[model samples]
Target: MTDGNPDRPVIVLVHGAWHRPSTWDATRAALAGLGYETRIATLPSAGTDPSPTASMYDDAEAIRREVDAVDGPVVVLAHSYGGIPTAQGLTGADNVTQLIFLSAYLLDDGESMYSRHGMDAPADTSGTFPLPENPGLALYHDVPEDVATQAVADLVEQSLLSFTGTVTRAAWHDIPSTYIVSEDDRSIPTALQEVMAAHATTTRRWAGGHSAFLAAPERFAALVDEIIRSR
Candidate 1:
């Protein structure tokens, strides 16, 4: 689309905690098939970086680098914990025209994953916490068996700082945004996602679990394509 030039806005995908860019393979492929240019922000708080101090702000800055580097319009599509960084990173980015939060957090200024989830304590007290041996039931119960197994095997440890870090600016406050709520999510309860979805300009729902992108890449890509074309 647009001859693969920077004229058309690109879809920058931000993945959730414990996940990396590889998690978006299927969705990215589908988007490419639809002629959408897509990019994935390297999450500092995720991957096998072995860095014990990556915070949410660091992740935000990583995304900001990608956002600021791009030309033309941008649709920052964030999933799960990714919503936090995208919300922070997109602040003051003139090129970003839209935001799409997929089963993700949309916190207010001074809010955090810990506070929003009502978890009195942070999961990464020791800097980073290893992902559970089995996240199938919590995050991938409804996902296809093979996909869920691969995703679980690929999960990385996430920084605890990201869990407790609070947002200084909520970009969604000034940006047009759509939130996709995962109705069957077990990691982030559907009820809570609905509450967060209220902060979005509009909302959509999917009868899937937390790992909706991996479980239903075609559907996710179709929705993203619609958003991009609407602009």
Candidate 2:
């Protein structure tokens, strides 16, 4: 597909499950310092929003709104569960020039976060899902203790339905894409990430955990900047 326009694209940030738009604060700040414009999607499955039963489709629609709102070219950067929705959201969105998947799931049409990962669709529990075993150690293994603790505390109840919803459109098929693989990710196995990343046009590997955006902010930001400039 064409680049659409010669102007620099706005960076659209999409956070994974259990996370709010605020989750991208550090990355946003770093990108801002580089004079890059950015926007984060407010996901319905993120828990704080009213809809507790929101599905991945809802998340995709939410992200689509943000992408369509931008006046110029757009580049989507999706993290973790954010990948599914962001990919669906960009369906036929010509303004979106490229997609950057960061330790993110890349599913095919008719596949889902649950099926692809072999996760049982979570039950309809009254409260949020339990934090992963040693969440801090798993998600932010390389991050500072305080930072990891704070990040965990900030997580909200992600809707279980989100994982079950199947992807209707795999936008990567039509758009240029890049995948960033986390070598030490404890949440999603590095091998699985590599399998899904095969769908991307290109891939890069880095040493970090699932939350590399936080643990390796400068390096992550630099990579993002490099991707943008190279485009």
Candidate 3:
């Protein structure tokens, strides 16, 4: 693999459940403008399969493949449910220098997303998880109306198994990490975010909803850049 830039580590972006890689278009562009190369990991759990069977472990494998494909050092930024797989994926990955959890679920070993949310795992995990009735309000309330509408339209059904699958290994236990809290997030409660943030090496609070990157890509990218430089 060719090194996009030997000076700066590649930024590997992991999108949340129900979201596609395209959701990071604005943030990726902004990061590129800031002299950082970015790569997006496509989660198998958030695909077009009607009877989705992919679990968080499958997503972890996908993330590992992306990280292993990078030639230089890497910095992974995981959003929402992406953090669970990310924590499991980066195990033994020496090239990954830092992990950034953006309004993400920082789960421990044997902890599933459902368990993290105080919900019991469903007995059957063969189907796709439905999106909220109003994703615009739940996820992108801070974003502009047009952007929120487009985001809602682009959402796909997430795999139920992904949420039910427990974390086998947590990479955050070994790797240095930073957690950025979305203060106004509705999807994941702010208190829950704070609880998860305690596991990170550093924690930051940003004023915005769950999808802050969508609402303010430039500002989000700047904050990311700042975090990267601090390392």
lDDT of 3 by residue, 80-165 (tens): 99999999889899999999999999999889888887899888878889988888899999998999999998998898889888
lDDT of 1 by residue, 1-231 (tens): 223444557888899999989999998888777777887898888857665568888999999988887777788999999999888878888888899998899998988888897777654365686665568888889889998999888888898878777888999998899998988888888888999999999888888888877888898889887866675
lDDT per residue (tens digit) for residues 190-230 in model 2: 99999999999988888888987788677788899898777
The CA lDDT at 167 in model 2 is 86
Best by TM-score: 3
Ranking by TM-score: 3, 1, 2
Q: Candidate 2 local accuracy as lDDT?
A: 0.84
Best prediction by lDDT: 3
> Could you tell me which residue pairs clash in candidate 2?
none
* Stretches of candidate 3 exceeding 4 Å from the true structure: 1-5, 49-51
The lDDT values for all models are: 0.84, 0.84, 0.91
